[model samples]
Target chain A: MSCWETIADYGLRSIGIGERLLPRSDFTLCQQFTLIGSGLIWNIYFGTFALLFGFFLATALAVGKAAKSPFIRKPSEWFIFVFRGSPLFIQFFFAYFLFLSLKSVSPVFDPFTAAWLGALIVLFLNTAAYSGEIFHGALMSVPKGEVEAADAFGMSGFTKFRRVIWPTMLRLAWPAYTNEAIFLFHATTLVFFSGFPAWQQRGDALYYASYFADKTFNPFVPYPILAGYFILLTLAIIGVFGLVNRRLNRHLPDAQKGRMKFRPNVIR
Target chain B: MFSFCTDPQSLDGLPWLACYLTTGKHMAFYASFGTVLILLAITAPVALAFGFLGATAARARFRPLAWLGKGYIAIVRGVPDIAFFLFFVIALDQAFEWIRHKIKCPDWDQPIRQGNDFVVCPAAKLPLSTSPQIWHEIYGFFLAVLTFAIVYGAFSANVLYGAMRAVPKAQLETAEAYGMTPRQTFWRILVPQMWIYALPGLSNLWMILIKATPLLFLLGVEDIVYWARELGAAKQARFSDYPHGDWRMWYFLALLIFYLAFTKLSEVVLARVTARLSHGQATLGGTGRSAAP
Candidate 1:
């Protein structure tokens, strides 16, 4: 079949859209690219949704963690500790199993078996803990002067936090937060490999890459393509985060402002 | 392990639990924890050395050498490490045998890549095809270690390079003014000062290395995850002493707890190390004060 015809067939294969069966024999480069690209849709979905929801949760976690009251601080600390302390791989497995166990009793909770729900839940919690820690640190490091300025303007507690502290905390945390986002994107690859089944072979980029690798017995080709896709994704994240970082640092003098230096490395 | 434990089905509650936990497969599962520690122990220093070499190469005067080092670090950093673990094991195995084919059988004209098979002479096989079973396991483990080292070494290189640059220019200038050679200045001033800066990144890298241990399953090694799944699957009562339901979740939960505890301990130790490293340094950790970066 022609490459365009092949693309049409496998373009939505990962979502169980076009192709019922994957290319089994005579594996083509076009098939690997199209299929893996399709699979990337899942990764983007997981990363995007988790990040969006995780952001607000993380803000709350950060504030709670920074709170003087033990009631608020303790749970935040423990939550961060539990999520950040465990491996994401094991987290995926444990969450999957927990979700599975939960599903046995309640059909209302059936969504956790699906990657959209299961993987997203894990990613959300994971990112919240990580971004929470980042924000906590940034909150602590919020300049004494900034707080004083807010206080002089009759700002206190909620008002102070809303206007001055939150923006600065987010600004300082953005770079590190950007790193966490990239890692989360990469961590999406583990969803299918963990206890969560791919659900009709609807897997991520790594899944499709592995499929091609196993079929051709050639890791060289497929993995590189997947790597290229991830690099592009990472670069895109850096670009977007860099723009945000620029806006956050816009107030500072050029000399004092920190450029968004790229430090692309994984915790796992 | 006790005589009474011989009959697992007859035991109740704690006794059954003790017997179950002490079973042979459980022992193997427990030993896989050691496998993780060993991987961490071996990979960390090796990766550091690789990183040092990489950084030095990248800093080298030669253009090609610098590009090679830069390229290695960049590519490894860019890709998901799972991809590296999956790809490198096969690639390295094939490359090793292909090289051996060239050396051991120079007269052979057959291509190494023939259809789906990678045909090297039997003599050219890694572990020599006649080595002991332990040799094969060790070889597989060694390959996993190399892949870990290659990937993590790049990360460490990034950290070390930044640490190296972070060493104050004044200290190097002072050493140069004192007539110390470049090498002496580097060893005495740069290396020592870089440690304080490098410690945080290196410690973070250590935690990551700890977490990456489960990827041993992907490399075809029977790591704890593999063992967990193997032992936790449903078993017929006739064939197995401890027949169980699909308890893979519980096994994985236990693994999760194991990792959580390990990472917590590492965090405590790393925090202490940072505190120690900060002492007497000009940086914020000095004088028992926390410095914000």
Candidate 2:
């Protein structure tokens, strides 16, 4: 078959859109690229939505973690501890089982038994906990002077926070937040590998890459391709996060740009 | 383990639980925790050596060697570690077997890679294919450790490189003024002081390494996650001694607790270690009052 037809055949194979069966015997480079590229869609979907939904939850969690009241602070601390303490792999397994058990209790959780919902929820909560810890650290580290300035201007409570504390906390948190975001995307690769079954084998990029690796008995080709894709995607994420970082630090003098790093070699 | 555990079915509540938990597979599951600790113990120093070499090469005056080090650090950092874990094990296995094949089976004329199969002579096979099962498990484990070291060595190289840079340039200059050779300066002043700078990053990496132990399951090692899934799956009463319905949630919960407690203990120990390391240094930790970055 022509390359275009080949693409047509396997491009959406991951989502079961075009091909019913994967390229079995004669796996070509084009097939690997096309199929793995299709799988990247799920990674992007899970990473993007988890990050978006996670930000608000993380902020709430960070705030709660920073709260003075034990009622609010205790749960937040425990939540962060539990999620951050456990491995994401195990989290995926536990979440799958939990969701499966809950499926009988109510139809609401049934969607979670599927990788799309279940894995995404796990990633979301996991990232939220990590980001919450990051934000909590940044919140604690936000300059005393900034809050003092707000109080001096007769601002108190929520107004003081909305105007002063939150922005600075975010600004302080952005660099680490960027790292967390990249790692969150990286962590999404674990979804299918975890207990959560990829419905119809519609797995993520690593899923397809591993599939090819298994089929070809050659790790060199497919894994590098997958790595190439991830590195590029990681670069893209860095580029995007870098822009937000610049905007966040626009008011600061040239000296303090929030240590926004290009190389993402931090905690995974 | 109890003598009263002779009739598990007749036992009720906690005694039955004790019997169930002490099953043979459960013993293996418990032993796997030691496997993780042993892997960490071995990998830490080996990876540090790798990182030391890598950082030294990256800082080398020679261009190609520096490029090699820089490339190693960059590529490993860019990919998800799980990918590396999965890929490297198979790759390393094949590479080893292929080398052995070339040496042992030179009379054989076939190419190693023909199609989807990686065919090799049985004589060249790792562990000789007839070695005791324990040897295979050990071999698999050694592969897991090597992969972890390689990947984590790169991570440490990054941290060490940054830490080396964080050392005050003036200290090196003073050593130079005293007519110290570059090697002398690196060992005496740079390496000694880099720990304070590297501590935070290394501590973080330690936690990450701890968290990464479960990926041993992916590497085909019967680590805790493997045992959890195995033992937690529902067992038919007729077929199995410890019959339970899909209790993987509880199994995983126990694993979760294991990890949390491990991480929490590490935090305490690391905090103490950090304080001890920083106590006499010139940085914030060296001061009478505690200072954290």
Candidate 3:
């Protein structure tokens, strides 16, 4: 098939919308690029949705963990521990099987079998646990003088937290939070590889890259294409997070504003 | 394992459970846990060595060497590690065979890439295609280890680079004032002190390495995930001696418990190590000595 024809037929092949058969021979570069790029949609979807939703949960968890009351603090601490302690791969398997068993009795929760809800739940919980730990660290490390100043100004309870505590927590947490976001995006590649079935060959970027490698017995082209896309994606995440970090630190003096540093070993 | 275990149908209740858990395949399943642990043990040191080398190169005076090292660390961090795992296994396999092909089949004219097949001469095959089954398994495990090392090494390089920077500048300068060479300062003053700062990152890396053991399944190694899936798949009542319904959920649950216990143990040990490393050092853990109040 011509390159254009190949594109038309197989562009949406991952979602089971187009060609049934993958290109078996004479695998074109265009085919590799287009399919892998198309598969990236799933990665972006999982990452974006998970990060966005995980942010709120993480904040709550951080706050809960930092709270003085054991009732509020204990569960959040356990949540963070359980999720962070286990591997995301095992989490995926555990969550998938757990969901599958739950689905056996209740059709209402069957969406767990599909990536739309199931994998997203796993990613959500996983990132929440990670970001929760980061935020907890930041919350604890929030300057004592800032809270003292807020109290001196007669701020108490919700007002103190709203005006002083939360913002500082976020500001201190942003850099590590940014790292967590980037890695969580990267971790989305593990979804299909885990117990969660990719139903109808519908998989993510790594999936399509593997597909091309399997078909052509050539790992050179397709994998690099995926890697390049991910590099761009990582940069994009860094850029967006940098902007937020800037806003978070806008009130601080130039020398005091902690620059966002990317740390890789943040407990993937 | 016992005479009564020969006929599972004759066993009842806890006895059936005992025999079922002691089956030959169950033994293999248990051995897979050892495979996971062995992988972690082997990959950690290999990846750390690679990381140390990469960190050294990145900080080297030579621009080209530094750039190459920096690039290795950057590219690996930027891409998802699963992508690297998928890519490297195939790429490395091809690379090794290509070298073997060049050395062994010098007079052959046919191209190695024929359509989708990578047709190397018989001698160039990774396990010679006729090697014993253990050799194939070992070869697969080796590729898995290499892939893990290449990826995790980049992470370690990042940590070590930061740790190297964190080592007090004055300490090295003091070494220089004592008439030590630059190399001696690095070894004598820098490497020893860097560990105090590097321990946290290294511990974190160790936890990540433990977590990454599951990716071995993706690379086609018969690790726990593979065993879980194989043993948990539904069997028919017709001819199968070990017929069971779809019990993958239970099998995977067991695997989850295994991992949780393993990670908990790692966390305890790493905590102790961090405390030990922090002793006499000016770090957070050092100041909070004898555990937090």
Candidate 4:
């Protein structure tokens, strides 16, 4: 079959579209690229949604961790500690079994056993914990002068935080947060490998890559293809986050602006 | 484990629980925690050595050597490390056998890559294929350690390289003015001072290395995750002495708690070490009143 036909067949195979069965034998490079690229859709889906939702929770977590009330602060601190301290690979397994038990308890939670929802929830919580810590550090380091300037202008409470504190906290946190975002995307590869089952042979990029590797017994091709796709994805993340970072530091002189360096934190 | 615990069905209450916890599989499960600790103990210093070499090579004056160092550091930047873990185990095994094949079976003319099979002479087989199962496990584990070292070496190299650059330039210049060679200056001035900057990153890497121990399951090493899954599956009455519904959630919970305690302890120890290392230095940690400025 032609490469175009192969792409047409397996391009959307990861999401259960276009084709039902994956290519079985005589695997071509086109088949590998198309299937693995298809699997990347799931990675993008998990990364995008988790990051969008996790950002708000992370902000809330940062704020709560910085709160004066012990009731609020203690839970935030413990939550961050527990999530951040444990391996995300273990988190996926633990959350899977937890959801499985929950499913046994209630039929409403049946969907929670699936990777799309269940693994997403795990990733969301995991990223939120790490990002919350980064934001907490940034929040703590927000210059005293910045808050003082806001108070001198009669700003207090929410206004002070919204206008002065939040922006600077984000500006300080963006570089590290960008690294967290990259690692979170990388962590998404662990979803299928963990307890969550990939429904109907539809798995993420690494899953498909592993499938190809298992079939061909050649680790060279599929993994590098997966890596190439991820490199593109990483570049895309850097570009987008770099734009937000530029905007965050727009008020600063060029010399004072914080450049977004790609400090790769290997794992979450 | 107890005298009266002969029959699990007849037993009840705490006695049954105690007996259940002492199963043979539970012992292996407990031992696997030692496996993780052993991996950390071995991989940390080895990876640091790799990092030091990589950082030094990157700082080398020769163009090709610097590129080699930079390339090693860049390989892990964008790729998911699980890919490397999965890739290296197989790739390294093949490479080792292929080299052995060239040396051992020099007269053989058959192509090594026949379709999907990587055929090497039996002499080239890792652990000889007839070796005991323990040898296989050890060989698998050795590859895992190497892969971990390689991936983490890159991360540490990045940290060490930055730390090397962060050392005050004047300190190195003063060492040079004192007629010390570049190598002497690097050994005396740069290596000693870079640790303070490198400590934070290395500590972070150490925590990452701790958390990454679970990936051993993927490499087929029968680590904690493997044992947890194996032991926590629901057991039927016919299957074994103890029959229970799925208890994997609890097993994983215990594992989670173990990791949390380990990381917390490491954090405390690392904080103390940072303070100790910061002493007498001009940095904020040194000048701060807590350290006898």
The fnat scores of all predictions, in order, read: 0.57, 0.70, 0.75, 0.70
Q: Rank the candidates by DockQ, best first.
A: 4, 3, 2, 1
lDDT of 2 by residue, A84-106 (tens): 87788888888888888788789
For each candidate, give its TM-score against the true structure. 0.95, 0.97, 0.96, 0.98
Candidate 2 or 1, higher lDDT: 2
Question: Cα RMSD to native, each candidate?
Answer: 2.0, 1.7, 2.1, 1.9
- Rate residue A139 of model 3 by lDDT: 93
True lDDT of residue B180, candidate 1: 98
Q: Candidate 4 docking: what grade?
A: high
Clashing residue pairs found in predicted model 1: none
Error of 1 at B40 (Å): 1.1
Q: What is the lDDT of residue B256 in candidate 1?
A: 86
Measured with C-alpha atoms, the lDDT of residue B282 in candidate 3 is 72
For model 4, which pairs clash? none
Off by over 4 Å in 1: A264-266, B289-293
Error of 3 at B40 (Å): 1.4
CA RMSD (A), model 3: 2.1
Cα lDDT tens digits for candidate 3, A141-226: 99999999999999999999999999999999898898898899999999888878888788888888998888888888888899
In model 3, the runs with Cα more than 4 Å from the true position are: A1-21, B282-285, B289-293
lDDT of 1 by residue, A202-260 (tens): 89999999988877777788999999999999888888888888888898889877766
